[model samples]
Target: MQSSVEAIFAPQPAPEGYAEHIGTGLTLRRSASRANAQQVHQLRPHVVEMAAQYDRLTMPVEIIHGDADTIVPMHIHAEELIKDIPNGALTRLPGMGHMPQHTAPQAVVDAIDRAAARAGLR
Candidate 1:
């Protein structure tokens, strides 16, 4: 389990707090009671169909993705999102991994702030 989680961080060392959080989340997702885990994993297949409704999304979206992330495929989530959404902005962090909010909290914050401005919320 540690090795699998380690791969998600890759070249970067996982910060202790974030690592623990991620590990706990992973444990929960894999537990027998987490029935919705499959539903979350299965969402990728519906992105194209769901994206057809992107025009109705009346708010801004900010996708902060790591180029090096191996957990969730970038093509399925971030790339597809930034391409399909009219008001979507992407911050692609090179050499970063899955946990951008931890490794680059400021970048995440900046993205949120940008999204807020775009949505007229800031």
Candidate 2:
């Protein structure tokens, strides 16, 4: 069973037999380099502090989130974001997971259109 954190961040399963293809020397080196890249954990506090001031934003904010997203739960991220921002709106897509931009591009575009329209930018 996946831990709650893993479930939330990596809800989708890797493609079958993907591990078997990672043995190439180039792949291993690339993977290792990426793993060693800069860590952003130290910035969590700063990010949270900035997010807390959402209501101060004057521009329209649109949150496009999948209802089935597990990595960042809709309630904890999208819903709360909408509630916190003065001009925020949420476009909740049912049966979609976290990567809505990849999984449902048209919906994401529609959400963008809606946001633009709401902001009178269309």
* Per-residue C-alpha lDDT of model 1 across residues 40-114, encoded as one tens digit per residue: 888876966887898677688888888888887677689977877777778889988888877889998899899
Query: Model 1's lDDT to the true fold?
Result: 0.78
Q: What does the lDDT read for residue 93 in candidate 1?
A: 92
Per model, how many backbone clashes are there? 0, 3
Clashing pairs in 1: none
Taking all chains together, each candidate's TM-score versus the true structure is 0.76, 0.68
lDDT of 1 at 87: 78
What is the lDDT for 11 in model 1?
58
Q: What is the lDDT of residue 83 in candidate 1?
A: 74
Query: What pairs collide in candidate 2?
Result: 8-70, 8-71, 9-71
Every candidate's lDDT: 0.78, 0.71
